[model samples]
Target chain A: MQTPASFEYERATSVEGAIASLQRLGSGARIIAGGHSLLPMMKLRLANPEHLIDINDLAELSYIREQGDELSIGALTRHVELEKSELLARHFPLFRDAENVIADPVVRNRGTIGGSLCQADAAEDLSAVCSAVKAKAVIRGAGGERVVGMEDFHIGPYVTAVGEGEMLTEVRIPLRPGGGSAHEKVERRAGDWAIAAASAAVWIEGGKIADVGVALGAVGPTTIHLSRAEELLRGKAPSEGLFAQAGEIASADCSPSADGRGPIDYKRHLASVLTTRALSRATARALHQEA
Target chain B: MHVSISVNGEQVSREIEPRQLLVHFIRETPDLTGTHWGCDTSNCGACVVQMDGQPVKSCTILAAMCEGHEIRTVESLEVDGQLDPIQMGFHEQHALQCGFCTPGMLMTARALLDENPNPTDLEIRTAISGGICRCTGYKNIVSAVRWAAEYEAAAKQEV
Candidate 1:
């Protein structure tokens, strides 16, 4: 009874072939990866793309490597791989933290990182994780590929900067010294969407917070980037007082709505508390105090 | 469209609509009703099956997408007249009451034991986190998986 509407399906043998099919199929076609998120929407008739370009066979797009000063992750990499990647854990433990709670292991075995980021669900974990790490998204179209930062990549709730006839190919995270990141999420139950989550990345230099990114999920239309909190934490000494102040800024700036998850005030409070906790953990890891 | 997939190690060719899910394909094509379909959505793990050695929710995958891939269902768990160790563990531990969540739980537990021969209580719970049993028979399920793990280890040692 929950089957999707009738549609045409084709498997893409290569990246170029997939791009070509996307160009030929036009806007009515959507790329299917993992199909964990998209299929559910399609079953509800919420998403009715007439043509599906299956990218599961595109093994070329599945990778995780350090390209110079950045860690480049292929779009087709499954959540399970990301959760267990020793490289990601070493560089950005936040990825493993978020992936651990993203969804159940069975779903994680099938869901891809590209699919999760492209879905751009407000309550999703990866969006906040990427935003906090200041990751750049690579979107490839018929013309060429364009790279967009997380700030520009997320346009709105369930909407991304990926245009028609275009597909997101990779997520690139810059590698910086003295950098550590952490993600904290609270869900009502196991494998549930975040009631309120905060992702924080802190880079320390000369014992001062050189740069930091704080983002909140499920508390707004898009992943809320705490620019004010980042600005406050930057150039400040890594101290509990400064993190508390940053948490205050998060509570003040984030816009959360009331729903089945909780009341607006509760979410706003979580934004502050979780942000503080994430910053503390990130700082601890940055200083080489905890693993 | 005409799609051919290896279900339970047997090639099954069928003409299925593009919208047909992999779960329905298995249940209808080979009549492997042992893989239960529940919650049509992917939240419930009742539709889980081994796709190329990985346990994936069948309801979320399109039959067309699984073309040419190896799919193993609950029916493949038994060899000859002997039930798989996992099946026997479930029976010995009373892992199910209503038996609705049994197939998915078994397949999920099987996949976990394959990857990690030894899993802690927390790990077993985490592996089957995707599965939901209204009977809330999780305690026995964990014990059953442990029982199977011990049985497999002992059998391997005997050889």
Candidate 2:
């Protein structure tokens, strides 16, 4: 296992206390929420830090609530709970569907939504889904608190817009009336990371598309939002022609690397196929709800 | 740093290095070797333990972070020398060969059945996905968990 050169761990009871401890630890300090992604990467010596400021005790960061027309999910909510949440299922069944494709039950129990977003792994299912859903991340730091769009949160592989000494506290997703969504991914196995994935959500108003979002995963440095594809389907009735065109656009837009998992061309092909499948499934759900 | 936590129905407090992992601390400090170390990393659930009644990879958590928490390892699965049903099921099914993975397997099974006594085949597969067993193709392992679930259910119904 990879061992840190040297490090310190502080268990902070409050958000302010955690921020203060992080400031004291200085440049090499990083907050550890669930540690599902960070600890594994640390063990591989891929990313090493000098200190880990534990923030699991901040119980305030583990809630899922409906506020007005949006759903605010705390960063510390475990994937298992997210999957089992009756409220999320009632309002946003997409999230529950997305949670099913995550790593595994053990990982779902330990992995936090914030940890996954902050890690910004291209192969991550939730990060891609967040972008497709246009979720906003609430981040807190020494300076203050601010909301960042999911598309802007990711800078590149293993990187995010979360600045130094900042922590993502919660994710805010807008609730659309009469909307439907789906997330689908192609993976080597049940518990393995996705080779490619897609998430699609559409808002149906008066038998026409009011909004559509499509995001791709594991095919680039970061998840790609197909704005051009979404634009093609906006205000149009759901149809195979539009989805197929968007799928083609998504395949063309992705810039995946050839790794041990598969060839670059294969991943690109899978991206198109999965995107098409996801959009098709999402569109059917939308129509079904309307009927 | 000094840390105090409950383990297997008992309270334990000790001073440990800040960098010590919970798994290492449990094995070295408290001398509870029941939680085996297969892959010192979190991929292999061999170091799995119950923290506050939820299954977590002990190797990933820092010992200092476990202060004031409740921890339960595979060693606590028995009652007065009577093996836990999961353990007995493993024995009856011959679920282990080298036995390196038994402790972790038993702990994972206990946690799964605790939450879901009657898990579907898919749920059972997902529950044990984090754990790795180089021995027997997991056929007997799955059978053992299913058997324990049935055994526990039947016992509950009798009472």
- For lDDT, the strongest prediction is 1
Residue-level lDDT tens digits of model 1 in B59-157: 999999998789999999998989999999999999999999899999999999999998999999999999998885599999999999999999999
Q: What TM-score fits each model?
A: 0.99, 0.95
Per-residue C-alpha lDDT of model 2 across residues A1-291, encoded as one tens digit per residue = 554345677777898888877777777889888887887777777877888888889898998899998999999998988999998876666688789878767767788999999999888888888988889999898888999998889888888888777788889999888677888888887677899999998888887889988999899988888888899889988787778888899889999999988998899888888888888877778767433
TM-score of 1: 0.99
Candidate 1 Cα errors over 4 Å, as ranges: none
**What 10-residue stretch in candidate 2 chain B is worst by lDDT?**
B36-45
Superposition error at A130 for model 2 (Å): 0.4
Task: Give the range where candidate 2 chain A is weakest over 10 consecutive residues by summed lDDT.
Answer: A1-10
Where does model 2 exceed 4 Å of error?
Answer: A289-291
Q: What is candidate 1's lDDT per residue for A155-218, written digit by digit as tens?
A: 9988999988899999999999999999999999999999999999999999999999999999
Q: What TM-score does candidate 2 reach?
A: 0.95
Q: Write the per-residue lDDT of candidate 2 for residues B1-159, one digit (tens) a residue.
A: 888768887777788777777888888745699888767767678888888878888888777777788889998988799999999999988899988878878888898999899998677877888888899889999999999999999999999
- Model 1 has fnat of 0.96
